[model samples]
Target: MPPPPPSVAGGGRCILSFAALRDRCFSHRFLAAGLRPLAVQLPVGGREDPHTTVHMWVPASPPRNPLLLLHGFGASATWQWYPYLRPLIAAGFDPIVPDLLFFGNSCTRLPDRSDIFQARSIKAAMDAIGVTRFGLVGVSYGGFVGYRMAEMYPDAVEKVAMVCAGVCLEEKDLAEGLFPVAGVEEAAALLVPRRPDEVRRLVRLTFVRPPLIMPSCFLWDYIKVMGSDHMLEKTELLYALISGRQLSTLPKLSQKTLIVWGEQDKVFPMELAHRLKRHLEGNSRLVVINNAGHAVNLEKPQEVCKSIIEFFQEPAYEASNEEKV
Candidate 1:
């Protein structure tokens, strides 16, 4: 990637730092896409101490159909949704990307770590921003939150799109060889990498074809910029997801859903995609992208965006023809 944007300082001297430069780069991209950052504070029930602060990207002008983009575990919303902004905007959709709690600038002092709590917080954030009804697009871990959001607030969530999110995964799936990792702990380590080698492993697992040789320096830089935050809390989130909920316990959603999966996904595997589609039954459409992995948005962004745009634009009666690439 290009060099990070120049860091700015309020005083006479320039405050040059890696963190500042990375923040500037993210801000520049968000502003370039006509998105302004807004921070909303959510007061947790029965908590008088520290409340939750959620940072989100909102359109400069009031958009017609709002689209909520929820990022996965690794990076923040900026890194995940920046690539799809142009296409989403061109398609006449307002994209609202938010950082999940303990990721990026979003944090909560609430004791609850379940996806239900996440769903509540996200709903609160949307309500604070005056988004009454919107479409939801979530990738990976964000898919869990999205599904919960759709289930809890069916009136608020219109259409749903889950990108490689194993919403149907049960605790038994881990020990049953559904994933490459042995258990949730190993998966968590790979997902939330602290070291450069772990980041490489994550990339290898996420992409259909990862770079054969990536410099350690570059990987370290990425880990420094994106990989080093709320490590323990992230791990807890994973554990809560696996242990707190199961496939049978999940509530069925009435919204028309789009299930997109990478043909070579190793994290959740393609089987989970089919399972999720089955769970949604007649209300869902499945799209499998060839040669892509868990990070299909980054690998085949155009195809993914096309699938989303088509799904949202096409009438519900025409969704019987499932598309595969």
Candidate 2:
């Protein structure tokens, strides 16, 4: 029989278990406020549904072309790809930023394990939005999604880019420093920050390099609506990747691919970029940003944007070869 449940702080109404609550506190310590509600989704699951929190941001005057932007782990779509979206729009490209289901504000309180579900939901969202052929860009965790997308639907993606993405966890130990939890209990224990100051401190250490100050009221607001209270979902996703059990599958990526990495990034690191470059089956290029960490898109937006633009504008080799002949 299941062991007697521990005392729940918010009464039986709270769907989260004691272990879930503990893990949420521990794991959520690094998630920043500016990156909540990754995007919006349709009315699919009820309050209990797992894919509720996914959202999308469409820029004004969306060009005939559309660019999809996926965010990093535990970050909202807007926060993760903010640099690219605005500039991409200004440059006459339609940019779409969608928060994956579990992380941001698409909905709260998903089942303890929902990465696969999130992936399917994201695909559904793209279909719903009528995204046919478009460029795909993913940062960090989002890069994993982009890689999978390129692998799964090679014909659909015009180009692919991974910015400081965490891929190949099974083949390598890139994510060694991302999560600090030793076990399930230790994971849950990080969900609740004792005070707002603690939250800020954790954010600075894990996410922001120079530390972007969030308003005090905003911190309190985030704590109130805090979803993703269970850390295991994320852990399970990582475990699946690390164990080589589950990740977006790519047989032979034919799309043009660009990989970007922050030279100083500790999470995925420069080696990850190198390894991914070696693995991709399509034409690919690598760009390393100096003095930047995992959040290069945010820390050095212009540089990142410049790289993207140059990549996009550079004519495909086939096109150039045909012209030359």
Candidate 3:
């Protein structure tokens, strides 16, 4: 016979939480993949007095083709990009994955929370590591940061591959019903969830088919660990990225760009992808994956990987190479 379950099943919940923590641990898996943790002190938010610390996982050897992977709003960079490390490395690209300020080990007390600031911080971090130029792959929230980086430092960021980044989205979209939520408050509730049910909503919004059996204890654990950090700042980042934004003012990229979107994405919607592709004016390719949602990277990792690999590997974007996707 078995001993009875702990009161309220606390023991099982603790085990699940511990497992989640272990699984989300970035250092172990990345270190095993030949990457190392690097903490660089740099001036962020364009201020000198309040220096921010940027943490990253990078290869020990200089990369022949370096690529920066920026994660979205959910978990840390490792949680989002771990699946791509081996595949990217095998493709002869050294992947630089960073926890943008307020995520993972990176933090700042300066209070500025804008994608431009995030971009500048990342560029400073790369310079400290002696990497003059590299490619970039940013998903969701990371796509906002990556877009700013590509805009501010075109020479440094040679090529860009954005997955479901709503760079072309105008602020009016929220009030105009282009978004799933009405405004930043509701958006924050989903992106920076504090409760178990909020996590459920996020999962539903992200995936084409969210898991049917998400244990409440696991959601609570994930919230306490992954989704609860730097709440005010993360919310500010969202407002900074979205509020008063207009595509007419958005700068077009000089480097070749690759835009990937899930056909069923409800968060930013498929129109934003088309808007971004058109905003690029030219020299950009859009690939829409079927049966995927906002979290296309996680749902269709192989297709996303193949698109990025081919994007960077290809020398130029021929008109003939463009697809209606």
The candidate maximizing TM-score is 3
RMSD of 3: 5.0
lDDT of 3 by residue, 1-325 (tens): 0001112433235555643555446557898899998888885445543347899998889877899999888777877787788898898899999998888888887767888888888899899889999999999888999999998998899999999998888878888899999887788777888887777788888888777666677777777777677888888888888888887888888888999999999998999988887777767888888888898998888889989998999998662244433
Tens digits of lDDT, candidate 1, 1-325: 1122222333332233454466678779889989999998875565422468898999988867899999998777787777799898889888999999999899887678899899999999898788989999999899999999999999999999999999999988888888888787987887888876787778878887777665555655666677677888999898899874578888888999999999999888888988887787777888999999898988888999999998888776544556788
Supply candidate 3's per-residue lDDT for 12.
Answer: 39
The C-alpha stretches of model 2 lying farther than 4 A from their native spots are 1-53, 59-63, 107-116, 171-208, 212-232, 245-252, 317-325
Preferred candidate (TM-score higher): 1 or 2: 1
Query: Highest lDDT among the candidates is held by which one?
Result: 1
Error of 1 at 114 (Å): 0.6
Residue 197 displacement (Å), model 1: 1.3
Output the TM-score of candidate 2.
0.67
What lDDT is reached at residue 69 by model 3?
A: 95
CA RMSD of all predictions: 5.2, 10.7, 5.0
